[model samples]
Target: MDLFNPYNLQVITFIVLNGILAISIYITLATGQLSLGHAGFMSIGAYVASILTKQADVPLIFALLLGGLIAGVIALLIGAPTLKLHGLYLAIATLGFGEVVRVIFLNMEITNGALGITGLKSIGSTLYDWLKVTGLTGDSFGLSVLQMKAVLTLLFLLLLFGLVLFLTLRLHRSRIGRAFEAIKADETAAKAMGLPVAYYKMLAFIIGAVLAGFCGGLFAHITTTITPDDFNYHKVVEILSFAVIGGSEIVWGPLFGAFILTTLPEVLRVLAEYKMIMYGAIMVLVMAFRPHGLIGTDTFAKLFDRRRKQAARQAEEGM
Candidate 1:
């Protein structure tokens, strides 16, 4: 019915943000790298975008893109040297980086020292005003102002998902993607085959960072306020959990995980404190049983192939 109500819209917006964060980690996971500090890159993007928009009156789109680019560049700088480490070592290094970022923000005068920057404009407010200017509000639609804003935000997030999905699929089919898979399968063998393993891994890490940064920019615009605490270690772990639980083998897996987990808190509101325990139990069960994730790459590929074959057979019968 009124799914675009403020409460529902808030939930939808969080889910969208979580989905983007999940995809960011998924990119690193695909390259067989476990980066646990995505929230740091996110903070970078959020602060940069917020500062630009609030102080300089930069357009939201430009601020977001610049934030993403800066995050990607930072990832390159961090990844080139650190990507050499594999497994737990890399995770630790990234985690440390995230902590360092949080600490820096905590003490920095530019970030207003822990209190964080506030009073930034919200996308919903901006959009609502713009629509009113264009005479698209009120009796034109049987919906509240919040509903219209929620619908617009949802549409925008969906558009973003499309772009991300397209680029991810394209990357998976390209030579670089294959290179990543090759290294993931066997680093030594991939190296033996003359592939630049380090470069490909760094590329994946940078891409993931850029995506997280972009999400952060959107987050700041939507929330209209951000604090250093928002991107702490716990947040990083949550993002990683979303990726692992969602099935980082494919791009859709993390998004699916983000949707389910982000909505679970609201769905289990009646349980209150117990909801967290229930969430943990579910995660434990999933890890114990579906170690590969709820939707592994093989399962999805086969399902799509089966559908394609079925469609082809039907077309031939028609002919």
Candidate 2:
């Protein structure tokens, strides 16, 4: 394929998809709740989308949404009961849940078990066909549905980032943020403050899980392929890597982390094995050097305060 061919667009598309994955991980991590089972939600999204299309002849776009809905429902089922668990236990439960999803996929006949889903119609192309049904295929370029989806994915990622950021900022600044901070600092204290600790924790989980499901939908359509192995514990670790790297600055922290780590693997292709080694090293250094996290609010506040002081000094000097 040509270098500038549309195939390269997949890489761009995945960066955005993975960015969303990183964003989803960031939400729970911010609340001091570490969920290691993002992959289960993602797998649910992917499989549901594929199954709906393959079995009942569902349209691609609707199937993608259905996949996300399925993931959210599963998350609600898993998250609601488990919200009462502590950090370590919650992490374990999520990880175990992911493993169960993987195992179930491995044994399922319709999913083709370990062989995985294949020959599935690309959502992009499917959209093209559906669009043609409504007369929207276009006059020139004649772009296939996959290309259309890639374009839409890129645009959607930007929109999602904005929407997530806006909501997160609001959440961080609201009474909820203080509650989240209190809970993160001392759950007992938060409860003493009359906060509904369980409810908020569940809320954060639902938000993050829904977003994970959304990202999974993007991944489902973009890759148009998935396997049980794709949603394993290692994936949970990877998403955590993104959250850790992004810092805890409410929003941009995770976004920054996602962008850097998402592209890190490709950037260090030469190092190959050491690339992963170096990635770990970087994470260690970041955690050590900036333990609160790469973009934690504390670090951001310090910088903001410094700038404010500098601005005041400059204003006096000009006067």
Candidate 3:
């Protein structure tokens, strides 16, 4: 079978996009916050980006960044009052916030009410146009335009994911990450130590919002259309499941989980009516047996350390 076929490529693209969304939620969870409002931020980004690109004729990159920044600003506003709530209360507040956002969009005249937005260009098409303008058509790359577009789209998304992953890794090792961990472990003690608990929580919330917004921008461009229903509470649950099933103890877990869960449905398509039933059963079993996910904090670390020790033993034998 052709792996690069359009259907497979679309699925792979969504996997990567969902991986980004998983990371977005992971950022908030890392800070001991249970935010279910990322879907709201995502909707803000999608609508803003769609409007800018479709109406203002803005460039794709600028539209995405602006959309993300706007979402961050909104997060700052919403978080200040709401982050004070803890545990289930915070989750409920955020979930309510998401529903509110959907309702607002659904009624907005600029968003065409419930009709949503469409006719926006795809990311690949935008890239292809730029390439042609630069005198670098598909013929220049010795491939058809469609193939060239696909390759560029994949490469661009991979680069974007790598950038986010790199930043997350840096944050994981930074003082801020430590502060987040401390807060997660004991908020009262963190505040006692004068770690600026509110500031860090707000910062984490804004960062997650920005990331979700960025993901939303990409989602809009990739799908070339978006609606209020797209960012509902169900989407919030799906995004959260990625981190939960993948093991949120480390950064890699959510991405791994996103890949598995996103691709599993396609793999199980042969099951027809039983596809969703099997999928739900698998998730249930994974949660029951491997509560920490398939990869916890020490999973990869232990594997690597064991391999290193085995290599050392072989070297000693050779000597």
Candidate 4:
């Protein structure tokens, strides 16, 4: 069992890409907002970086950041005016924005449109080499290009989850999180209490977009080729679905969702036409049973709490 097998390698890559997109939407979902335009940021990041690296001869690292920045800027521009809206209306508006982005890219001569971008350089082990040089060698073994990507994806997931948890927990424990919860619970009362509803909502949108941009950059590197088809409206829905299927409150839920969902399609591929049907059935089942999602606040608390309670009961019984 050589660890460097290509199939294993591809699976690792898929996990990284899936993890990034899943977590990207997870942030937005945490804010209780559902966006269907996340692919807009993704498109912006992919096209920009691909063009920069392959066309303008920019360095890979710089191209990635530039692409992310471009996407972030676009997201900011769009989010500022739109986050104030609600529900399906917001989803519709975002869906339109995503399509518009896709259409524009499709029509743009530079993008090569529906043909998709190909022949880009693959993201290699250079990043991993740098990590080893910095003394990550003890517990962190050096990796092949694919393994490095998987490790990076895992690391990025951990980092993003930690940062998001820190912020949300701080807010949850503070006046601001209360305001957000208040808004989620009852927007009118929250507004009456002078909560900055629009401001915070917009803040959430922008931050979520930035993360999406970062993920898109990594995505561009991972695929080493891209197309408008890759970041379509369906893709946006997929991102949202992962966050939805996993309860948004679970710190690791979206990643788990990504891992499962990403792997599921492959498992079902043998079913051919029935694969999509099975996928839909699975999702419907999840939604029907896990309404608050797989890890809502009460649910997540109870999970760890259950173990502690069991221990206490055992201790009393022993006494």
On residues 146-205, what C-alpha lDDT tens digit does candidate 4 reach at each position?
A: 666556544554565466557655755776555556666777777898888887677667
Better of 2 and 4 by TM-score: 2
lDDT of 1: 0.87
**Candidate 2 Cα deviation (angstroms), residue 135:** 6.0
Q: Which stretch of 10 consecutive residues in model 3 shows the poorest summed lDDT?
A: 1-10
Candidate 4: lDDT over CA atoms?
0.74
The reply for model 1, stretches above 4 Å from the true place, is: 301-319
User: lDDT (CA) for every model shown?
Assistant: 0.87, 0.76, 0.91, 0.74
Q: What is the TM-score of candidate 4?
A: 0.81
Q: After superposing candidate 4, which stretches have Cα over 4 Å from the reference?
A: 1-3, 125-180, 267-278
Model 4 error, position 180 (Å) = 4.1
Alpha-carbon RMSD to native, per candidate: 3.4, 3.3, 2.0, 4.0
Q: Quote the RMSD, in angstroms, for model 4.
A: 4.0
Summarize candidate 2's per-residue lDDT along 175-212 as a digit string, tens digits. 87777778888888888989998888877787788778
- Model 3 sits at a Cα RMSD from the real structure of 2.0
Q: Mind giving the per-residue lDDT tens digits that candidate 1 earns over 99-191?
A: 998899889988888899899888777667778999899457887776888777777777887788788889999998899899889999999
Which 10 consecutive positions of candidate 4 have the poorest summed lDDT? 137-146
The sequence of per-residue lDDT tens digits that candidate 3 reaches over residues 222-314 is 989999999998899888888889988787898899999899999999999999999999999999999988888899789999999999999
Poorest stretch of ten by lDDT in candidate 2: 1-10
